[model samples]
Target: MTTLIRYRDDAPQQALESSTDGAVIIERLAALGVGFERWSTSRSPLPAAASADAILAAYAAEIARLREQGGYTTADVVRLTPDHPEREALRGKFIEEHTHSEDEVRFFVEGGGAFYLHIGDSVYQLLCERGDLLRVPANARHWFDMGPRPRFTAIRLFTDPAGWVGHFTGDGLSARFPRYGEPYAGA
Candidate 1:
């Protein structure tokens, strides 16, 4: 299930609002200039690929539509498992609050993670599982946590050739917030 936790940016441990409903997640995110969509995995067949090129080729049609609609120029696949040695480094890098010049779009092909978007005075914690497609608008302050036991396959869409370039806010607020895989119910 997708979850949404709303809290004051300064008080991450105390949630002002929370929900596990999909419609509510979409509605809340949309109101904040973010886009959320749940795709049917059965409708889009994703073949196992050994290379990024093959992965992109397998989902060419879907990638094409998203690229055209969002004006994105590049598409790629990122897969990380529990045994990945770089899991900690990856988690640490993204756990810092940051913003990108181009919109950050990700479609979860498998597994799950959490996206913490700091907009206005509230932080929106989004737990995205398989089939979840989340688009964070350009320059939106956010951070992602893939959990300690990372396990996910995502298709990332980018507008720039440089791909993802984050401008870290160095606010250190992410440390106070809940990380992925934690018990977020009623948070």
Candidate 2:
């Protein structure tokens, strides 16, 4: 159940719009010059299932393609898995809404997550499952909820190799966007 929510940057108490429809999501994101797409795996050479050479080849091709299309130079995959004692605490206290100063992009390599983007008068609630990718533009103003830091993993992609250096919320507005549930597995 991937969703998209849009709203004013200063408010997160409620979404201006939200939906699970992929086409609608894509359309909304594309309007902001952001990219959102869903891909499926046939259990072949799609990185996770690939061997050393296969992985290298797949990335090489992707690098070339993205570089030509988006002036991308590198492709890096970073994974986050939390087993912290305060994982639940962090998740519970995780609703402090904020936004990246640049494009926020994530690809669910294994598990899933929630990406809530604040657009003008709307908050796009994106419930990203495995194989789903989301790109929220820089300064898009949003927050992420992984459900109290549950045992979830994801592969993140970024144009900036440093990755995920977010500007924390000082306004404390994350309380507004709609929360997420388990993604749709049979859709």
Which candidate tops TM-score?
1
Q: lDDT of model 2 at residue 123?
A: 55
Candidate 2 structure quality by residue, lDDT tens digits, 94-177: 356676655665656556677766566555667777667676777767777876445444434456666546676675555544
Candidate 1, residues 24-59, lDDT tens digits: the string is: 888989999999988777644455444677666766
Which residue runs does candidate 2 get wrong by more than 4 Å?
5-18, 44-64, 81-95, 182-187
Model 1 alpha-carbon drift over 4 Å, by segment = 43-58, 185-187
RMSD of 2: 5.1
Q: What is the lDDT of candidate 2?
A: 0.59
Top candidate when judged by lDDT against the true structure: 1
